[model samples]
Target: MEIVKNRFLKGVTVVLSALLVISLMGCGQKTDAKTTEAKTVSENVKRMPDEMTKVNLGLPSNKNMSYLPFYVALKKGNFQKHNLNVNLSVVQGGVLALRGLQSGDFQIISSLPESVITGASEGANVKLIGTLDIQSMYSIYVAKDIHDPKELKGKVAASMVPGNGTDIQLQYWLKKHGLEPNKDIRIINAGDNAERLQTLQQGQSAVTILSPPTDLKADELGYKRFLMRDELKTYNHNMIAASGDQIKNKPEVIYAFMAAEAEAVTFIKDKANRDEVIKIVMEQMEMKNADAEKSLDFVLPALADHGKINIEGIKWAIDMVKEAGVLKKEINLDKLLDERFYAK
Candidate 1:
């Protein structure tokens, strides 16, 4: 009777041990499955979007020649190839584009360095990423009756808009002639390219600043080109700037744009593809062949070498602004230039 009871107890103990082993195995299997699932979930997670990183391109309207490199890059899909989405915004004038950049409406503003320096002095968060034009592609045009820049003391002159690159250049030209701006010359803020054209035609302004396409228009209308860069011992233009915040976060996008831009500048400068490039320039700008030619001529010397930043040109522009009382404090020129990206 004792042996039978002991045997029954042993059988019960064996059954309970088997059940406990099976339950432990089940728990281990569940733990392994959860670990696998957690890893899978981690791998499947999506990256957070950089809401602050976006490219806003601002250029001038009507003067399509100024946008040659950008258009070439866009039409050739260079920007897209580099994994960037650039929204091209055409403003009325370069100054307006600078203002848009300052007001936070645009990310990249295309204009002369003077505007950027002025904005920086005024405490706007801006920095010049790169320069497209290193020399003066602009000329000061006056009526045929007026030859000397000093002849327009009492006469009315028009610029693209107040504080625009055109205005700043015109002021610089005026100062070079030993004339005081705003006091010696009655400078008016004509709206933009079209308005400046209208102002010149309607005799609202005796003298006006003009670029290639507009200068071609001015020539067709018989406006006299009294002064060009060849006449002045100066380098006149530069691609102004973008926000500093944009530079820190969206450096990769800027690198892509700069690389493509460098290629476009090289292509435009090549004599082999000159005609084709001119045609593309005309088609993109919607200008006549004569205007296209004029713009190409203007862009020829102003365009810098491939992927090169004009440190001297930028310094000159900054110095000019400082002299003009546009900048309140001096800035470190080296800090403004970041070439480490290209090096990488």
Candidate 2:
């Protein structure tokens, strides 16, 4: 009777062990299924293309080194990396660029802070997002025979469209030297940098304001170049601006664009990447190595801190426009500038 009882307990133990083994196998199979599922999901995510936002960026001119960060961002694929399909359109002047932005022809614009301020004061719905150069990138280049600002009196000064940043700066500079713009020096719309340079060469104008490689070209031609920032200082020269609708409706796109611009500015400021940057400048602006190097040297220090806007600079620009009689009334800073996108 004892042997039979022992046999029954052994049989029960065998049955329980088999049941446990089956349950463990089932768990293993479930675990393997979950791991496979996770891997498949990850692979699909990797294969899917990122949704790119298309943006049109308008600029007064691309020939100047002031726009180098944008060029770098485009050439280095920084915009693409941030999922932006950016298209750059070069207009003749800041006013035209702003007009394009207002007309919905451009999603963003790089223009003078003064232009944005003036536009805002005039009921235009635009806001400054970021700045490229905190200091003025312009320099007054005179004919080879001219020595002083007074020498430019009764002579034509070549400029972009009236109310453009260059034209406004020229007027301010002339006024500082006791030379009224229209009376002492006649300012004319002589097209872009290259065309303005041609005007000087062809004897159509005696003085003009220019930036970068164009200034270098002017220097080579024996033109006397006077730096605008030497005295004017802290003017918001080139700024990134967008419409109010863009700021209100597409905040994420604006942030992405600023992120790409910040990255580009960082890449440009690095000394280790000097040669590559110079190469990019040469390719974009069609400049020689020496000219590119000189232009880069002049512009590198003037770039804003990671494309961030300068409040003091913007204020200075506003005052300048008011003094120049370009801006008639006071502008509200809160309405003119939207810092949320680039606050980081």
Candidate 3:
């Protein structure tokens, strides 16, 4: 009787162990099923157009107005409309932005036409796709005491840097006014708008080239506007550019980006949207409303209308850079202007 009782207890123990294992297995299966369901649900929803193309776009921090269209497109959902995943990076200046383009850090860069031309001449395989502004909103502000560019001769004239757009303008301005670059005038590399402003304030430099916001500030501080030659009869203050390889391989992506910007341009040009435009520009630039408003008014006329590429503006830029002796080779105009993606 004792042996029989012991065997019965062992059997009962085995049965309980088996039941416990089965219960644990059931719970595990349910958990896996729920996880699978969640994954399927996540996969079913559309995922930002599957990142059809990736782009790194570069802009300068100084030209808050020049980047207004980009900000509008981002805030207003134009980029998503065209199905593009573009990453826009704010840089110190247009020259640095162009450098990012050269190193393949960014696929598209907004810079002065002169920088692009100078880069192409230096063997960087890049081309201009479209423009943001095609006229002169820039001015040379000399110390109120200095009267003329000829007076600027032999005095220290400061700009961001050589090969930079503003510097190119300075060079062109001096040349037009019959001042030789190195001989007739002394051009120094002043760091940026802030540096230029400081140099002018301290009287370290007699003249400096400045764009909007800073330019207006310079004017308020009593810096005199020296010349307005409008070197570019057809000027592009800001442009979109990419490598030749990108144009060939990812033309569709490039076109999509241009299309989004075109929509932004339209919204910005409409005076009815002035408040909205100022809000976007100010927020993106982290600037005051008053400053942003002044810059917008200054650059509005120069801004490209919707998606239109002003061929004349491009020609003017090319001509100015050529005269500055920045370009070593002839720019193929047809190869440069690619506006097929913009809506008619």
Candidate No. with top TM-score:
2
Q: Tens-digit lDDT track for model 1 on 216-299?
A: 778787777755576444453657366777666655556666776777787788899878887887787787777777778878
Reference-based TM-score of each model: 0.75, 0.81, 0.77
Model 1 TM-score?
0.75
Task: Put down candidate 2 lDDT per residue, 74-138, tens digits, no spaces.
Answer: 99998898789999888877788889999999989998776788888998989898888888888
Query: Of models 1 and 3, which has the larger TM-score?
Result: 3
Clashing pairs in 2: none
Give the per-residue lDDT digits (tens) of candidate 3, residues 165-221: 687787877788788887877788878787888898988888777776677778778
Please count the clashing residue pairs in each candidate, in the order shown: 1, 0, 2
Better model by TM-score: candidate 1 vs candidate 2: 2
lDDT of 1 at 158: 83
RMSD of each: 13.0, 11.9, 18.1
Candidate 1 has its poorest 10 consecutive residues by lDDT at 45-54
Task: Count clashing pairs, candidate 2.
Answer: 0
- Span of 10 residues, lowest total lDDT, candidate 3: 42-51
- Cα shift from native, residue 254, model 2 (Å): 0.9
